[model samples]
Target: MNHHHNPPIHHHTTTTQILKQSTTILINSNHLSTFFLLSFLIFSLRLNVETATHSLTSFIDHDPSIKSLLNRLHLPPSSSNHHSPRVKKPFLQLTRVGTLDDDDFFSGDENPDHRFFDTARNIKKNQTLLFFDCFDHLGFVNYSDNGVRVPELVPSNGKVEFKLSESVGIDEKIDADDIYSENVNEGVEDFLKRFELEHHEMSALLFLLGVLSASYGFAILGFVVTYAWVLGIVFVVVVNDLLKGYKSFVRTLWDGSNLGLKRLSGFIVMRWAIRDALTQLLGVWFFGEIEDQYLFFKIFVRLKLMPFSIVSPWVNGVEKEIYGFLLSWILLDTLVSFVFAVDAWIAMADTRKSVREVVKEGCHLLSLMLHPAINLKLLEGIVCGSFARWVLAGLFGKLFASAFQSFMEVYFMVTWLLYYFSVKSKDANASGVPFGQRELERLLEDVR
Candidate 1:
């Protein structure tokens, strides 16, 4: 039981087993590496071929004139008289030389009457002739026993100078005339249609302007009526207050004393402060709020009649929010104006105070009314109120100067986006490709 047992005798050779395992591993690794290397080479070659093909196709497709030139140069015998026996000898000789005047150079002649080589030499020297020669090579233009005839090319040169019969030239001329006349007639018809469209557009614009003028007139009339009613109420209240004071003041002044001068000066100061307060408040309330609301309503109505498909729903929502905020501000301002008017009426009625005290009170009221909401403090009311008045006056002054800068930034951004979209839309339409939603979104994102 304690004795150790030997291993089995049916064992594999260690060297053979190691050699077979190593060979198999090496072969598999080599195959995988070779496969990967071949794959990489094929992928790179495919990419290069695709890039080259794309470039070639782009060039050929973009230039119609080049395509036409190639087509003209490669026409078949049935469609082309380019190998005419008459010019074959000269044509072959010239092409074989590889350079002009080779024969003349070999003959040692300086002046070789190159005018005889005018048609061929001109075709070689002039680029314009290349276009015509290409057409002729395709048999679009052909030479008879007399000369060449190409009705399409005639307009480019004004007239053809070929030694042909009168009847042949006349026939070619008639055909060219018919083509030119057709082109002219088409142009005239297009011009007439464009003119009519422009005239109709102008008429529509004029009618819109007339309607706008009428609307503005009505708005102005409404503003005038509102203003008159408010002023009338103020006038009645002020007149009643002045009548109550007239008896006392008139008698005191008739007493023939210079003491009335002090009272007069105080009255003048009080009146000036009241006038200034009214001007500032009404300007903000009427011009900034009421009139702005009227204009906003008018603009909204106009936009509702416009092509809504051209505008995004998000933009419409933003516009509605803007109008809502403006309307709320307008209502708040109207309430503030009414409160100011009531305060003015109350001050006018109070006749117990001395003129100096009235002047001080008027100045205080004006300062309190003009002060911004941010600075209004409940604690240290008198001291904080005075500071707030001056601070708000300075803030408003700065805001006035900065307003134009803010407006300009908004204007430029809107105009730039509009112009970019218009140009992109036109280019896409011209290229006969419709833009996808993602592409439009990307364009808007870039603009933003």
Candidate 2:
């Protein structure tokens, strides 16, 4: 123990070391505090800017006048005048009318109106007869009363009229007598005499008959050539081939059954079955695969070929399955197509939900970062206290940022949900079914 009071060198050295350590600790602490404060401030400022911009954008979007102004600036109309309103007319009118049964008006007797009409008709006939009688008694050979002989109405001379009237009256009496007798010979002689003189004057009628004869001859020739010869041979060939094929199919399906052999019943059944199966399966797969694009065409073909089958319970089930798969395929195709079609900004705008998810994850990270530790109890208290103070001061700012972000996310989610529900409701309505949240939940309940 060189107790020689050696100046306390070790103590001085230890004191200097302690001072350096304290200075370093103070500097580091100050740096860390400054960094955290700066970070918090910057975060707050950014949040405020973002929130203000979003609020401004929402205000502009919601303002009809602002939107109209933007529209005018971006897209002026080609014409300046406003269009006039269209005029329409009412066409139909509902009116009340009395109703009466036919039996009530008619008591099984001739209608009085019908008797009146017949009487008027008889009066008109009598007037015509009287006029003709006066013309005959005049014996003036009147045609148009002005002595102009109308070609089609050439009147007979007086002598000719007298002779014709006498002959006609005598013939009428003779005709009446002949009608009561078995031998009606009185008019036959006169008719023969008339025909003998008129037969040579009948050239016009003969010419018409000749023309008709010629036309019928040509028609007969055409009919023989077309139907009896050309079509007959074609019909024979087709019938023969059909009968041969039918026999073959029948023999294949039923070798020895007498009924199957008769009328080619086996062939008919086999052919129909094969055609049905092939058409049903292939048609369902091909048309149902491209349903959205080809539904109308498929429907037309199916209705034309298999209307009854399509309405059958079995086919209805098949159709539903086909349509369900088609709907799923179309949805997938649409999603894929949209992936290629959408612009970057639009896609990003639609990802507000994703941003919210990211923010939630960030909150978890922050919680982890702010977790308290037992080892550095005093330091933890100081940090937490300081953090709490800053947070309280900036609470509104933090909340504003969070609320803005959350609003965007909520708005996007709600919009998407609305769109999805609207489309689903429309489809269900079109299909004559009800769609609601309950239905949707039921559908998705078993999806996962």
Candidate 3:
């Protein structure tokens, strides 16, 4: 009755559980610093563009002529206005991207009761009225809908006619032919010159200095981040070349050309570099263009390519445009990912395979991308992170937002690269052999 129970034995598995595999890869000390440096360079360059634009726009907003025009037009301030109170305002002037408010008002589609027309009629003869509704600027219109009211600002009395040039019609598209007269163009050019802000040579020189700093910073980052990969790729190509030459004399002669023997790795790196540069350029250009609400309301309109409208009770045209642009980018990203997978297969996996075979093999990876669990994880990390970053920028400042953006960029790049590697490994395992690495090992064995 005095027997003591033996202490329970615990089993320990050799394989450690990775809490979040992607996060583990991202935080690796070897990669973290390089990622942050790259992010800093990117953010700094974008900040330059935003700074230049903000400087120009701030000048326009504070101009007496522009202020007078806005006041006389009775247009409300932009909902997305970036102005700060006097005490909090920076002496050197810091600003956010876009910062301009859009103008919209009564629309033909929404005013079935002629309320807009009635309101316009009541206004005095000399005053100009801007009329609109949400649907007017939305680009999708039901021409036959009974709810549509033709926007006519002329009052009942002949003496109170409002000229077309004076009235701001939100829905009207300006025809080039109508405004092409030299006299009209000259007058418009003269008007714009008054609002244009000129930069001193000193400011231009300073901007050039900032760009050079970013370039140097990026180059330094490349040494740590890209140099290893470049060397590895070159080594792989050289090993492959040596193996082919040892295998057959006829093939060795032909394969020299096939191996892309002339600056092979350099060409590969250059191509990828160009692709990356274009992608960044396009993204920055789009961000700058889309944030301009003044340009959107005055010059641009929705493309009408969407099958159905994304109607929201509270969302304005600018918000809708942002959504549209985001959706477009998502689609473009997916297509680019697929193309990248194919390119990766050709470059790293097997150059001898037919295009169709490569594509067929790569299709297996699509399942991974479309997996519900993975999709949810991506949404949580990317979409939520983006929203949070934007909110933090609004609440705190750009520094916090820039940090978040850099982190997110690292996450995005690591996630996709890992996905590619995982898919490739799985494919090799299914085929009952290692592929790329195994070949390299065999080449080493032959050399030995």
Candidate 4:
């Protein structure tokens, strides 16, 4: 009998190790300033969304003392067997006493939060609590629909029973023309003339289009094609930007009356791109969905690499969320930004020479492909960017939402340039090339 025992798996510890190692590589690789600019421009929307979301959710106010006092008075539960909670608290009570017709029920007050908030007084025992304002008149009440007839709400034999349906007393004002104007643009001129409204509302309509473009468009493609869809989007958006940058680059390369493919590694660039996408997909899976108020971004910046905690303190409440984001961003996302900064400077110094050097470096890229963990971290930035594009764009603005998406396009090429140079520089150092003088001169000659 063969007694070959397979080793047991250690999942948690192994995952932890991988995360730590990946984090370290993210910090050590170059391009910090660029990452911070991208992160700040992009993640700020998420930060605001996080804060507003918290503020919105906190509108539900609960008074335990009042509940306990009522309990001591032996108040009977609204229903026998007490399956659903019917013991209404004082804060949830509504102010109006008179019976409301369906018209009154359908036509709710314009300012429910300000008027009906804590101002609601004594609740009737026979009456059911349908609407409530908990946070000092702030809007945090939930009104559910029960489908009961309107006449049923009138007191019957001193016993008032009302099962709440999602009926609120207020009707929201919506511009029908604004919604319909997209597919039918002619309606807008009439709408503006009819409503006596300004073009400011047009901004909102345009923003609405952006929302549809990002979400509807992304949902159709992002899920159906996955990675390939992301690639297509990046390609479409950055092709112009890359061409603009590449113009000066080409002029510098061919200025000497010679054009050579050896000066650029087409195969190497393609390989890196494919590998980078795979690494990015892995990073997205590793990081998972960022469900908790920018929690993933928060944890990444505070590590030894970024050190954002020095300027910011870790406070409790919502402020802690921001601090965590700053701290976490420094370690995980800064490397590529630093790499971009170096590449930009190098390109600016000598576009032609930089191209040749990068091609030379690209040939040796395989030798330095040992740090996929770092690429995983870089991919996380794109994930955050995607959230900005699809989720926050509607909440914020289209331009703001598109910032990171735009950054990712520019960033991929920049990082490629940096990666080649970093490896080539390392190899050059091994060959007794002075790290500070030789590479620095090549990188900064245009500056001089």
The numbered model that scores best in TM-score is 3
Over 4 Å off, model 4: 1-360, 373-381, 384-388, 404-421
Compose the digit string of candidate 3's lDDT tens values, residues 65-140.
Answer: 4333322222222223347211111111111322221112211122231122112222334333323322222222
Cα TM-score per model = 0.20, 0.14, 0.37, 0.23
Which lDDT tens digits does candidate 1 get at residues 128-161? 1212222221223343332434464333213234
lDDT for position 316 in model 1: 31
Per-model CA lDDT versus the true structure: 0.31, 0.29, 0.38, 0.33
The per-residue C-alpha lDDT of model 1 at residue 329 equals 37
Best-to-worst lDDT order = 3, 4, 1, 2
lDDT score of model 3?
0.38
Cα-based RMSD of the predictions, in order?
42.2, 40.9, 19.5, 21.9
Which sections of candidate 2 miss by over 4 Å? 1-28, 74-448
Alpha-carbon runs more than 4 Å astray in model 3: 1-19, 52-294, 297-362, 368-373, 380-385, 436-448
Model 4 weakest 10-residue run by lDDT: 302-311
- What are the clashing pairs of model 2? none
Instruction: Please state the error at residue 300 of candidate 3 in Å.
Output: 6.8
Give the per-residue Cα lDDT of candidate 1 at 93.
15
